[model samples]
Target: TVAVVLFTSDLRLHDHPPLRAALAAADEVVPLFVRDPGVHAAGFDAPNRAAFLADCLRDLDASLRRRGGRLVVRTGPVVREVDAVAVECGAAEVHMAAGVSGYAQRREERLREALGRRGVVLRVHDAVITAVAAGAVTPAGSDHYAVFTPYFRRWSRERLRGTCPAPRTVRVPDAVRGEPLPSRGELSGLSPGLPTGGETPGRERFARWARSRLAEYEEGHDDLAGDATSRLSPYLHFGALSPVELVQRARSRGGAGAEAFVRQLCWRDFHHQVLAARPEASRRDYRPRHDQWRTEDEAAEDIAAWREGRTGYPVVDAAMRQLLHEGWMHNRARLLAASFLAKTLYVDWRVGARHFLDLLVDGDLVNNQLNWQWAAGTGTDTRPNRVLNPVRQGRRYDPSGAYVRRWVPELKDLDDRTVHEPWRLPEDRRAALGYPAPLIDLADGLTRFQHARGRGVT
Candidate 1:
């Protein structure tokens, strides 16, 4: 007997349900990854993510090889490639982790139909991509929880699946053929400071963080200057680290910080379930506010300035510059930067979401789109009218101004008190610093947003 394990968002061998099931049910298994052109057509194959994905594939292949097997790589349509491999290997079944996106759901449906025609069964595994599968828990009256607090209350109680060890040995059929694995060197336009990707690096980082930093997470997660949060998001986005193992490990540590980090993991699951229930939220508003957002023509200069980190809002510009240089931004930075664009600039959330997807190494459709909407007052944020003031946010989170100095070097010489509001400096001194003036007066932007949202201007 033979089975094929189709690798999608879930890339690692550890705690991988589909792979383990395949190895158990078949004498030999074909571990497969397909480079689907459909993803490119959907405009998701950005260079940073592409480069990161190359590293993931290479690492997966290397891991499999260490177990006396190799990942079979193919290109073109996903369903077609999987079918061809199944036919070649004469596999009795194909197994894959369940996916949340509309594209992933459609791909799964197509694969089932196509493989069924070939007299092979398709087994879709849940709790593989996510710690808790989408739709596992629901409100008494609804298919999904629209708000997070209620969902988290329920999600916290659900027992996560046990972790699976990497197989001591994996047997692959001799007849299966695969393309040469891709290399990150072949890709361009990647962020210069983008971290290397792979399950090995991810696990090592997690182990170190769990030992040393989990205790400080609650107190320091939003300390932009301290950078105290664990940078495991890119690994999570690629499924290089299992959500299940992370939750388990954090809970074992048993502290306020560990609980806080677990809550964040729950947030990831929360967004996934929301996206699963409402797939159109990817392109359309989950809860529409009839916003007359500024188009590119109206907002071109502001948007360009925001993208180039020249908005003259020191903290916001620092965040944008960090994103450009590192391909990742602190969580607090993301919130303020997103707010500056969606709320202060009164630009469309979609515009900012598109740019983030282009550059973020850890960009996932559900999180990126919904988080942007949440910031823009069009999604599930209970306080839809709330606007984050970048200067105030900077003063609170990046109090020391070290984060700004690191990213926006021109402002390094300024005092911590003056760093966030360089415009407050004397004319000659401000000019000497070479930072641009604030894009729009903070008061003016607030009034514009309030008026647009039908609130009386203060």
Candidate 2:
């Protein structure tokens, strides 16, 4: 008997349930990956992620070859490609990891129907992409938890599935043919500092960081200049690192920092469950505020300044520039930058979310759109009206101003005290620095937000 294992977001060999099940059920397995044109049509195929995905696919193929097998790559409609592979391999069963998005759900349904017509069985595995599968633990009356705190509390007690070991030897039939693997160099407009992607690189990164810095995450995660937080997000996003294994390893190490890190992982699951239950929330507001948001026509200049890192708010500019160069941003910087765009600038959160998805290598619809909504006062944030003052946030998070100096080089000569507020410098010195003035007064921005939200300015 033969089986077909379809690789989706869960790309790695380690702790992969779908692959293990396929191997156990059949003597020969076809490891298939279909480059679905539907995804490209949706406009989700940004260059940074495309480049990273190329690296991942190459790594996966290499790993399979090392195990005496090879990945079968196909292109076109997903269902048609999958069906063709199954027929060619004479597969009795097809296995895949469960997905959260509406598109994923629809794809799964179509595959099931298509395969079922051929008398082939489809097996969907849970806990492959996330530690806890969506809808596993839910409120009595709800399909998913709307509040993260409550969800985290429940998620903490649920027993996660045991991790799966990678097959020591994979057997593939030589009859199956595959296209040549893609190269990252074939992709253009990729961020210069985007990290290399692959299961090996991700595991190595986690091992190094978990040993050295996981202990200090509690104290230094928010310290912008320190850059102490583990940069494992891109790996997690691509499923090169399994969430189940990450949680298990972090807990065994056992410290306040490890505990905090686990909590952060739970947030990832939280967002997944939310997206699963409310798929429309990806493009629509989760909790509508009836907001009359500013369009590009009305806020074109301010939006352009924000995107180019010339907002004249030193810390905000630094964060924006970091995103442009590295295709990633610090978590704290993400919050402040998002808040500035959504609340301070009074622009639509969708606009900011679109730009982020355009460049963020780890950009995900569930996390990115919902986070933007949370910052814009339309999501699950308990304090929806809160605003982050970029100046104050810079002083608190990037105290020595090193982060700003590194990214916004024009402001490199300023002292820590004045680096975050260059407009306060004497007229001659400020002009000499060549930094633009603050685009809009902080007080005025706050007042505008308050008035739009129907609250009197304090």
Candidate 3:
């Protein structure tokens, strides 16, 4: 009998449980990927992610070919396409990685139901896309944990399974037919600085980061001007690198930095589990915060300014522009920029979340949406009302103002202190600098945010 390996988010060959299971179940395995139109229709198929995905698929196909097998690609509704391939290959079982989003859950159910009609078995593998599968550990009272610290504590104590080995060789049945791999060039409007995809590139990055910076990550991760954080989010988002291996290797090294890095990975899983339990968190407030958020009409121009990186707040604008150019932003930048938009601007969190997804290579429903909620005072933030002061944050994290100057070139001539607030320059100096006046007075913005929350400034 033939076994079909259904590739989903977990695209790499190394440390893939579903692929290993499929290979063990049968002599001939058809590595299949179905491009579901539903994803495109739902707008999850953003251009940058599509480009990154194309690279991953091409890379996975190449890896399979080197082991004497090739990927089988098809397009259409996933259930229909998967069933078609199974029948054509005469496969008796299909194996896929479990996913957390609502769409993923729905697709798994539909695939299983469709295959059941053909008398074929469908197997779903956990911990393929995350270090620990969602729901592996939960608080006693609820289906999911609402906060990160408690979840992280539990996740830390639990033991993880060892990483799986890549198959020595994979054999493809000659009878299978497949489509050509997608070209990333065909994707339009991709960010110019988006990183290359594939397991090889991911492994290389992990190795370099482990040897050079893993130790410093504990103290230096938030040093924005230093650019010290690991640029591994996109790789993990695309499943080009195994989170299981990342945790294992980092733990074996056993340093304070590795522990800190592992904690961030747990945060990733925390969001995943929350999304898994409450898929509506993707578009709705997780806690139903009674926020009288400002309407688009009231904040349209401010939102436009923020999107164009012309907010007149150097740090926030720099982060937004960096995201536009790089398809990624530093973690501290993400928090500060997000807090600026959702808290200072008093805009809806969805607006900022949508824009981030539009440009972020690591854009994911769980992390992006929930993190937005956390910033908006509607999610699990213990101190939900705290606001990030842009100027203070800029001076603190970007002490030299180098990061702001690098991305917001209009202020390039200004020195460190003046760079954080060009509006404070002498009238003639500000005019010559060509930087716009502050879009909204910082005090007024703070007042609006507090008033929106039905509270005065503390």
Q: Total clashes, candidate 2?
A: 0
lDDT tens per residue, model 1, 88-118: 9999999999999998899999999999999
Q: After superposition, how far is residue 350 of candidate 1 from its true place, in Å?
A: 0.4
Q: Give the better candidate number (1 or 2) by lDDT.
A: 1
Task: Note the clash tally of each candidate.
Answer: 0, 0, 0
Candidate topping lDDT: 1
> Global lDDT for candidate 3?
0.90
Per-residue alpha-carbon lDDT of candidate 2 for residues 357-441, written as tens digits (9 for 90 to 100): 9999999998898888889988889888899999999999999999999999999999998999999899999999989999999
Point out where model 2 deviates above 4 Å.
Answer: 455-458
> Higher-lDDT candidate among 1 and 3?
1
**TM-score comparison, 2 vs 3, better candidate:** 2
Pairing residues by index, what is the TM-score of model 3?
0.98
Using all chains and alpha carbons, the TM-scores for the candidates as numbered come to: 0.99, 0.98, 0.98
At residue 450, candidate 1 shows an lDDT of 88
Clashes of 1: 0
